[model samples]
Target chain A: MIKLKANGRERVWFYAFLSPWIIGFLAFTIVPMLTSVYYSFYKIHVFNMNVVEPTFVGFKNFKYIFEDRLFLKSIGNTFTYAIIRVPVGIIVSLLVAVLLNRKMPGTKLFRTLIYLPAMIPIVGSTIVWRQLFSNDFSLLNFLIGNIGLGPVKWSSYDNAMGSVLLMSIWCGIGPSMIILLAALQNVPVSQMEAAELDGANAVQKFFHIVVPMLSPTLFYLLITGIIGALQAYAEMSLLQMPGDSTTTMTMVVVQNMYRMDGYGIGYSSAMSWFIFFVVGLITVVFFRVTNKFVYYEG
Target chain B: MLKTENKQKRALPLVRTKKTRKLIGDIVCFAVALILSCILIIPFLWMLICSVQPESSLIFMNPPVWPDPIRLVNYKEVFFEIEMPLLFKNTMIIVVSNMVIGIAASISVAYAFARNRTREKNIFFSVLLATMMLPWVVTLVPQYIIYNKINWLGTMLPLIAPSIGGSAFFIFMFRQFLMAIPKDLDEAALIDGCGRLGILIRILLPQCMPIIATMIIFSFNGSWSDYVGPSIYLTDPDQYTLSIGLSKYLVANSVTPWHRVMAGCVLFSLPMIVVIFTCQKAFTRGIVASGLKV
Candidate 1:
């Protein structure tokens, strides 16, 4: 390896080459992150683009976030959504991964098909899904109708949340499945054979061998999944109707940022920050809990 | 003697049980796999069906799961009504340009991080890693404000220019892939009087095909799907990409037709689908090999 010596002036070129990202991050991401924390304490007016000199209103925004009805509802909605979606998404992917791992005919075609949803842009896919779940003529309602069931108002108040969740799972299954499938491939074939030789049935082998060995990949997926679920706003934005059902808390914050204008901006930032903290905390906790279970062969 | 012979026959069958078990295993696996495949393909099949159906017939009280008479008009309507071709062109420019810039910048920077053992390089690379953990939503407004002030908001500058530095995740990916490559090639090139740039371009670049292909597809897919950036930056309707254009269609009115939206989606997603199918293995391997730490 021909290593370059980091002499006094050579450091300048190194710094220069790295300037694009460093400057951008500091100015855009870092500064904004810090400012958001700062602004969470004060009121912000989107119209004026001023923070109202940040009157030292400590925890008021946070307090309001907890007390507000929509905010509270959103918190409940978000938690329920994440809790259900994360596991379902993981399970669906795992199932797909396992099936694809088998020496079956058309495995290649199945793999390609599984990855199709990820290739579709989020907005476009959401649009497609929205139409499929449309109240008047959704593909879903059509399918349901065939079974002699009433067409559910999928995008309406009660059904809308479920619709969004379904959409998320559909779009998310592909990438997670792809990653898990790759991980499955990395599992040693010898382990399976050894179990078989030891008189282990397929069920016993899966539980005793496959599941334990696959835990690390599973842990990784969980961490990434939580991070993703917390930041999920695309489907909500696309599926949200004019009146109400689509109004999850994240959407509320974004709507405040876009439509509600000014009074709620500070509060919204605080709420989103709370989400960030919660997500980060959940991820750390997951790692802590699953660390013991994660098996590393090497 | 007859009883002894019968006992021997039973023992022989028991000893040959592995072959029977193998046959059962294959049959079971095939049966289970077919069911799983059907579940996975349902959505895509629905999408195909929806894309071809006429708008009027799209939402019947008891609509057919499959299109009875395909309407080619939905595709035509998407092109004419939504100006999908223009959006495709617009998105392609951003996607292609950004991919080139991102790849160039990432390869060089990743090479430095993976191979160059300089103090400054280490710190700089660490900074890059740290940035990846920070959420982009935090900085989105600031970036938009900066771009707006710089008079690059409506143009593709804000969308394209920032990619020249490459993404943190992509940089990390390339670095990992580069790390796995043998260092002796670089040593040999150095002995031949090849400069660092020449070694990178002629030697490293060729061997880095899979990673490069991954980067290209990823960048294309990311930029193509990017809605938030374009929705925020591009105020002009005519400048909308497929993402923004599709969003406009969906959010326009309560009575948006399902068939047209599906057709538009199918049309918009063709590029990515085509690219992914063509380089499926490379894409999967690139992600798995690069993402996992040794």
Candidate 2:
């Protein structure tokens, strides 16, 4: 190896460049991650908003998760939402991308409209959806009344989960749509043209050429979607009202921490790790499946 | 000559048939896309109406398709009655501070990772990617404990410090952008007696304004919408950002009047929507460019 003339000085600047993240990780992320592992064994109480030195309970917190009814329900809710939302979100977004792929009039306008909702802050969108799903006074009720259907209590047991699922689908489709649109554009026009010349119809061309080319993007979105859906805390927390019949989410931790005035910080920490594990497992599964099918155009 | 004539003769009818088929396809695609886009955008349309209408007009058996007598009172109330101005200032303080640090740190480390070939580089890079998979929620309690021991709780330190450490995601993004740049530029800068820092500050940064802009936008949006961090750390009413403030508005108005609460939410979310619409081209480009590597 050739020695650089400015080797000593270069090292100083390199360390300087690296310090922010290094310092940050040591101070913030790594410290917190390790601390949380410790906290998973302790019981915490919020006395006057000051956390008392957590009582070391050992594996009690982990055991609580298995025993608690709400804890088990939350796990089921999280997985069910992910399983339902991920594939549906992917399929809808992919379909939208395919529709927007062609050079039709006002296509750009439609694309913009499609992507607009992804920009709205989660809390903001949830508030709007709340009003739309209001039992006594909702635009949905009005629309349904016109068709002679009874007004539905959207947040009730019969519909609450489905309503949230629909909202999830609406909010997520935009980003995936844009990604798929880009992927579609990257597909070779020559290949499509050659297929047409060989007397392949539109469906044949799409199924054989477009779908294969779009798989990598589909896979990427699928993994990220799973990760995102697993972390579905914000909308659920916001949508939930006091005394509401619905309960589906990671928001139970936040709700317990904030509203219940009971601080089982250790139990919450255990729950959080469980969510992380599920997400990690899903991500691994996605990688395994996608490795077989995703066509790397690059 | 016969081949050319036969091709032309066949192409003429095919062109006519193709146009007819394409038109039908366009109509079908347009209708489908229009309906889906409407589904996606309905929340936003409702939000705009919620912000402008009177609290009374907002709550009806059948919500009005259009706001009647268009009460512009909510915006006034949000500014005067609610301490939204203070909330905006608080959010800006956190956003600006972190944006500066995140960009500086991410760009520098990204440059190092992109150009340098140290022995530990691969190990460090994989570790960085691995960290991305660790959900923030898992770290929440532990980080809180650490912060508690250090007595940094109830301050913005908990919120801002992690960002200064180059975010794995942003670092990855910047590295990818830097990789796209020609290496000759760095070599030329080095030949002219520019040190790595000098090259980073002088030559490379100037060429990376688009990416810098992208980083700033995402950082701003992230900080702006971030409720979980500040909420966990800052329990003081004065310390709350817009996100926490919006949530509080809902909780407080759970029974009082949802119209006013929605109005506040609409006002709170306006910045995000406006930013997105204006900079969507850059937004999509930035995300796509960053995601290409992942």
Candidate 3:
């Protein structure tokens, strides 16, 4: 870090340049964070415009959340969704990236086609997915029928979460593939050549060289992916899968706060804070455990 | 040269077989790529096909691969009956306002972080990056409360006002782009009596057009398609953005025409498709740049 002795004018200009972010940080992030924490310990009731009050509840919300079956079920659903989605998403993306990184014909066109899904808005794409997975008239069921398989009820209570995972993986694979592809391109060609000269097979070379080299990017993706999956709401909302066995934790938060007439604001705040803690803890554990495996090529 | 030639002669068959192996690998890769591309493209193609097909044809067990006669009535209905023009106008207002405010705020702060070399600045930058990992859920309820208290609920202010504060990701992108620029240019401008703001506006901004364009495109895409923010804040039908409007249209009337819904989806996604195609290089470069930084 280079230390520069700035004059009074430059110092003033420096703060001026940073004022917007500072103001935003305070007004948006820090205040909201603190307020959420504070509100979690109280019963916040808002009646119309002028009547609003927050009474101290002191751990009742958290206690209620722990005992709440819906909260527990949502947490379970969210975990199930994340556990299925994240690993499958990573593997699929890595496979696609590897395929695209190869010197193949029409690689650019193929890359663009695969990535185009990520560019579409989630709301619109979810609607398209609902149509595609509709049991009665679905294109998927039609193809499956041609192959002599039974029509799958994709949006049923048993399969709703699975359908959500499938759509998410499809929509999400593009960005992850782009990241992994970029990482794969950065693997030094000379190292691969050296590995080849040592009588290593293609699989051996990929596992020993490419996977390790790509681990840092994979690690980054894993953390972000887990966080994203845990906090997923838009897809669930757009897909209209709410308050069932498939209600995710984030959906529960939204449902309790917004859809439930704002009566459970404190309880919802507690739920949100609980998710924050879990996500934060998972992220920390990931960095601690995976740091050794991530290769930082200098 | 003679010894090398002799070695090469011995290695010729090995190289030939290696070439064959590589050829097989490329073929396999191409096959896989083709399958994956088809999987990705089929949904959008289905949307397009369904949007033009009449409602009677959509109820079959096996959907048609192509629209017969290709009626444009769905789009016409979406425009006239669905009030899509109002949604578009509402969306554009929020998108354009957020883009302008967000870019200005992000660039200035990013410029500050890029040019300054102080311990406190580094700490602030790291805090900003840390905030990126803080899920939006953590702030959702509290922010809603704040907005409700201020009576900005059911208004665009709640959706648009928060953006005036720089977004962490955009700020990071701008900072990274600016850091790649050399400091000597700033020094030269300073010696020529250029002020700090002038150096940013006159020198850095021109060179950083690609990143600025990237920011604009991303902000536009994000604000245009944003559902959660508007859904939470805006309650009035008249104030609904395209995303909310389309979603409500779909959810409110399940028995409504699927063709019209598909038409609305296409219209909602059309601008982004055009932006992606037209600014393909910048778009990919921006994504790749962010990915590489990770």
Cα error, residue B243 of model 2, in Å, equals 3.8
Q: What is the C-alpha lDDT of each candidate?
A: 0.68, 0.68, 0.72
- What is model 1's interface RMSD? 5.6
lDDT tens digits, residue span B31-118, model 1: 7766665655566666667778766445343455457578878888877888888888899899999888877778767776766645
- For all predictions in the order shown, the interface RMSD in Å is 5.6, 5.6, 5.5
lDDT leader: 3
Judged by DockQ cut-offs, the docking class of candidate 3 is: acceptable
True contacts kept of each: 0.19, 0.46, 0.41
Instruction: Report residue B292 deviation for candidate 1 (angstroms).
Output: 17
RMSD of each: 6.7, 6.5, 6.5
Clashing pairs in 3: none
Local accuracy of candidate 1 as per-residue lDDT tens digits, A1-298: 2334436445554555556566556645666677677767877665543334446688998887666776666666777778878999999888777776666566667766767766655644554566677776677776667779967888777777787788788777776665555455445566677787898997798788777766766766676666666666666776655465534545334534432455666776777676666666776687578767766542
DockQ preference between candidates 1 and 2, better one: 2
Q: C-alpha displacement of A181 in model 2, angstroms?
A: 4.1
Per-residue accuracy of model 2 over B1-294 as CA lDDT, tens digit each? 979955765678877767777887889988887877776677777776766666544454354646666777767676665689888888888988888888888988888877775546666765665566655666655566677888888888878877777677668666655654546767877888888788887776765664565566567777888877888898778888888887776667536555566677667766755554454343222332332332
Ranking by DockQ: 2, 3, 1
Candidate No. with top DockQ? 2
Better of 1 and 2 by TM-score: 2
Q: What DockQ do you compute for every candidate structure? A: 0.24, 0.33, 0.30
| C-alpha lDDT of residue B179 in model 2 | 57
